[model samples]
Target: MTVVELEVTKSADELAKTYIVKGILSEKKEDDALHVAIATCAEMDALVTWNFKHLANLRKAELFYSASLEKGYLKKLEIVTPMEVSNYES
Candidate 1:
């Protein structure tokens, strides 16, 4: 298994802050925002997670996608579960 390099940039932090400020993610969930922001800024293909309420919901996905685009990230980063990715690989 290849270990993905964690990319944490200033832009990523800003993106996370933006989400919180816009109420896309609650203040209590800044860490969750950071996870998505890092994945987005790193240009990862997807963010694999089990946290449905804060990290793996479709409504949040749409909002994150738009926020990322607004921040000039052109790539569409998918938020999914490990099982979902495994199935996709087949």
Candidate 2:
């Protein structure tokens, strides 16, 4: 098993702050932003979340995607639910 640790660096902090200040996410949901930051910082292609109210919604995803681009994160971050990307057989 491979372990990936997410660190809170200066850039990640700034990204998280941007997410909060831009109203993309509430301050109480900072961890959600941090999670996104981690994914963005790692240059991940997608970020799966169960938080529909914030991360998994179309509007919020658009805002976060735009913000990431504006912040120089070139790759588009696909915010989606586990079910959306899952390969579970019924």
Candidate 3:
């Protein structure tokens, strides 16, 4: 990747870590948080995960969405499991 690409990636990484440090993600689930953070930062409409204990739970989803909105992530995010999506598609 070009220097600019590398820099952008670094910035996104920092932002993901910031979410954890700021308590947006409980218990420092860095990898799981990173996945959600990426989707949030990218302005995706949904994050489909099997991580019901964290990323896919109602409480955690609410927290993530609220914190993201407060931090200027305008697009509201939906957290769902892959099964949820597949069922919807079916």
Candidate 4:
């Protein structure tokens, strides 16, 4: 159980605003909230969580990946679940 720190940055408020506008809540909202902030700062490798309802679903992951790509945020952003990473033997 490795816990990764999600420090709030200068852009955190703006990130939360964006998610709120999009009507996302709870885990989904939190995941995007953190990712948006990280995207703004370009300071994270992977966002590991177990919240498949939001962050870990393949469909949602792809959408997030594509959105980040379009915004030039993909270089530093990756969203995956703990189980997804753990499943990889290598």
lDDT per residue for candidate 2 within 1-90, as digits (tens), equals 233676788998899899999998899999999999888878877787788987899998889889989899988788889888864445
lDDT against the true structure, each candidate = 0.89, 0.85, 0.71, 0.57
Where does the lowest 10-residue lDDT sum fall in candidate 3?
A: 1-10
Estimate, for each residue in 9-89, the C-alpha lDDT of model 4 and write its tens digit: 656555555544544435446756666556445556667767778666676656555544554454545667775565343
Query: What order do you get sorting by TM-score, best first?
Result: 1, 2, 3, 4
**Which has the better lDDT: candidate 1, or candidate 2?**
1
What is the TM-score of candidate 2?
0.85
Q: What digit string (tens of lDDT, one per residue) describes model 1 on residues 29-80?
A: 9999999999999888899999898878899899999988988999989999
TM-scores of the candidates are 0.89, 0.85, 0.72, 0.56
Looking at model 2, report the run of 10 residues with the lowest lDDT sum.
1-10
Give residue 74's error in model 4 in angstroms.
4.6
Candidate closest to the true structure, highest lDDT = 1
Which candidate leads in TM-score?
1
Better of 3 and 4 by TM-score: 3
Q: Which RMSD values do the candidates have, in order? A: 2.2, 2.9, 6.0, 4.5
